[model samples]
Target chain A: MKPSSLLAPVLALAPASAMAGSISIDLPRLPVAEYHRPYVAIWIEGAGIQPRTVAVWYDADHRGDPGTKWLSDLRGWWRVAGRNIGTPPSGISGATRAPGHHTIPLPADLKPGAYTLKVEAARETGGRELVSVPFTLPRTGGKGAGNGAGGEIGAVAVTLP
Target chain B: MANFIMFKSLALLVGASALALPMTASAHRQWLLPVATTYSGEDPWASVDAAVSNDLFFPDHFPIQLAQIKVTAPDGTAGAIEHGITARHRSTFDVHLTQPGTWKIGTEGFNVMGSFKVDGVEKRVGRRPGPPPGAMGPGGAPAGTPGGAPGRAPVESVALDAIPANAADLKLTEAISRNEIFVTRGAPTTALFKPSGKGLEFDPLTHPDDLVANEPGKFRFLIDGQPAKGLKLTVIPGGKRYRDAEGGYDVTTDANGVATVKWTGAGMYWMTISATDNKPTTPRATERRMTYTATVEVMAP
Candidate 1:
């Protein structure tokens, strides 16, 4: 089945209020010798303040060694907040996703200020990439998008209402 | 002959060859390069290599003495060095990072080296067979002799009061050297970054383990617990064997004793700084030489 079809149901289940402020992430499929789902982290950060994690997707369950063992591979996120948040962070962690568009709801309690949304992805035996989009709180008129350098990630779009 | 003697004493004081001095470009640089500066998982082990070589990160000249190395955990407690081995060119060791946060691995050395004259005969202060046990004057017990490495020739100098009362031309030089690197098992911490307020030290505005390429990293230098002004800092990236040119830069401290560098690329970097001053905490010493060296890995942005 097409990966985009898998997102229809997830989008339908999202609360109407969450649709007001949400981020859409696209994981690009690449032609390579070996394939593995990329572990990803999404977070919001502002000037002079600690970053807030939005979502983290990885192989939460493995037989012997858990996927958290390689979270540091996502250097950009690990250095900022992942290391402190601990494994399977309540309410923010999920299983790894297949190649396609994935939408995540933003926190409603975010204060009114200028902030940046960062999406970082890392894969085994593959390259890492980060995509960033700057947005202001309290609902801006249009949508913002950032394109990754094109390795493990594709395009990330943010919609603020 | 006097120049050669001075060179040997400087080598003994710093635990490397005379070429290891920071001032000379042709000099051999000393460093402790880790396999990786950051790690994750339930149990992670960090392996490090210690050497003095002409090229950065390539162990070729001589292995740093394992005895001089020390490890400090994030809680300011002593860490252990395991499975240590010294090869022809480099010394290797393993550190099992059982605790979370940052760990420090390196060495600190202090020695007094100079010459004095008794009965018109010039006698060196630091060398094999120091003054007799009786020569240790009241309250002069050869304090701070750099780790007392076993089986190695003792380089401890005689105490100030141990010098003959009739001794003339009493000249002494105090030397302090520090070399270190930081590794983080999970999250980076500053518990191991506290300055000892003695000799040359680091007051990092940016955590050493959190450095990133293309971003400015600010670090302050301190001498005797105070800001060090006009100090020269040299940073050289590793992998010199692959590049035709030496990719490194030099920066000087401002009045605030802070040196800022925006790394050009991502890799391990060797940093070094040296200073000379007449201020000596030990009595009768005419001058002091201080040197600090560190190896840090910069992540790609």
Candidate 2:
């Protein structure tokens, strides 16, 4: 019997998070204002609106938790993509992110289907932008690449990886 | 430090020569950041009085652990304001030097560090936050960062909604409502609510609370008899725990519609929900909003 088993409960406190396939969001270079990294929402939309992943490069959750609460701030994604949800579901989440690059993997147990990924960005004193990427994941292997639907507006839907 | 409660009165004198209407009655609310100083000088250990846009009733009711206040002084003493949150709107910071200088407060200046121009100098990295690096050790991976570190959890979902005209309004919504994550294994599941729609301004977590408000206003816990107040709330601008002081707060309303005292440092916490009133133009009474929806509607029928 491995002695490590004795302290499994203590180890259980630190749950292991799944590495969902990451997504790369490219910001548009606006001539006018500075573009702060946006609060991007990636979710599997079905039965109206359901949020699967919230990738806010700039906000926060519990105490020091970081993530996005300003789904509406992502102008383009707000209309059809990142709206309705007020808080995140149990399990995994955090505060927001700063201006730069962010990568998030797809959930292994993600129900395979026509899932949509929504990306929205907003700066406190600057501009707002949104981009949606739609993808279809394989039932078994987490193999896929998100389609790049880059632009600026209220909502832009991109196909799944 | 002394506390201040600003009774915002947004009186917009609009000349409606086109409509020929008598002083148009528009409801308005002034974004009043009533600052108080422990010692008065140019900036004298000043703290920008922040509310969760909602007030918190109990200790567990407040959110927003700490706030990152960045200021660029005229002489250029480049430093960010780190305020320890307390009972929602009742928050205060040491005010560092408390000297006078030009200050521009915003979210995410440069990287995770507080980087602003001080006499044309930049910090380049996040300031030396408190609580040290250990706090994030359990879940300190740069959240939302693609291929983030191991300590943190991966983002499971992200969706956009209700795109606002300007970034500030949208950022406010994100800062208040959508940006929350509850730990299942930890303290019985907490929901950190940032009453304001800005980065870590006022992020406070309520025990076992999964719901929060996007717009500022009054909110009832429903589970408890007390109402969840919406003062202004925030978290450490970045998820950096060291920068945050008390972790959360709420501005509970007393009989005079103000908080009791100022915010001092404490411990870990979540977001706060208070009565965040909308700045209605004229003819509009102080239109109050509740961050969390209640069974009883305040709308006068």
Q: Please report the candidate that would top DockQ against the real structure.
A: 1
Candidate 1 per-residue C-alpha lDDT over A132-153 given as tens digits, one digit per residue, 9 for 90 to 100: 8777876555444344345666
lDDT of 1 by residue, B12-74 (tens): 533633312446656777789999899876778899999877899888766787888999998
DockQ of prediction 2: 0.01
Candidate 2 local lDDT, B1-301, one digit each (tens) = 1111111100001101101111111211111132311111111343443222221212211122234334443344565556555454334443354333223332222111112233432222212222222332433433224544455444332222222223121211111111222211111111223233322222222222122233123222311223233233222111122443323434454332222222232221223233333432212123322332111001100
Ten-residue segment with the worst summed lDDT in candidate 1 chain B? B141-150
Considering chain A alone, report the TM-score of candidate 1 relative to the true chain A: 0.82
Shift in Å, residue B44, candidate 2: 29
Query: How does each model score on TM-score?
Result: 0.81, 0.26
Which segments of model 1 are wrong by more than 4 Å?
Answer: A1-20, A47-49, A143-149, B1-22, B118-120, B127-166
C-alpha RMSD over true interface residues, each candidate: 1.4, 16.6
Evaluate residue B108 in candidate 2 and report its C-alpha lDDT on the 0 to 100 scale: 25
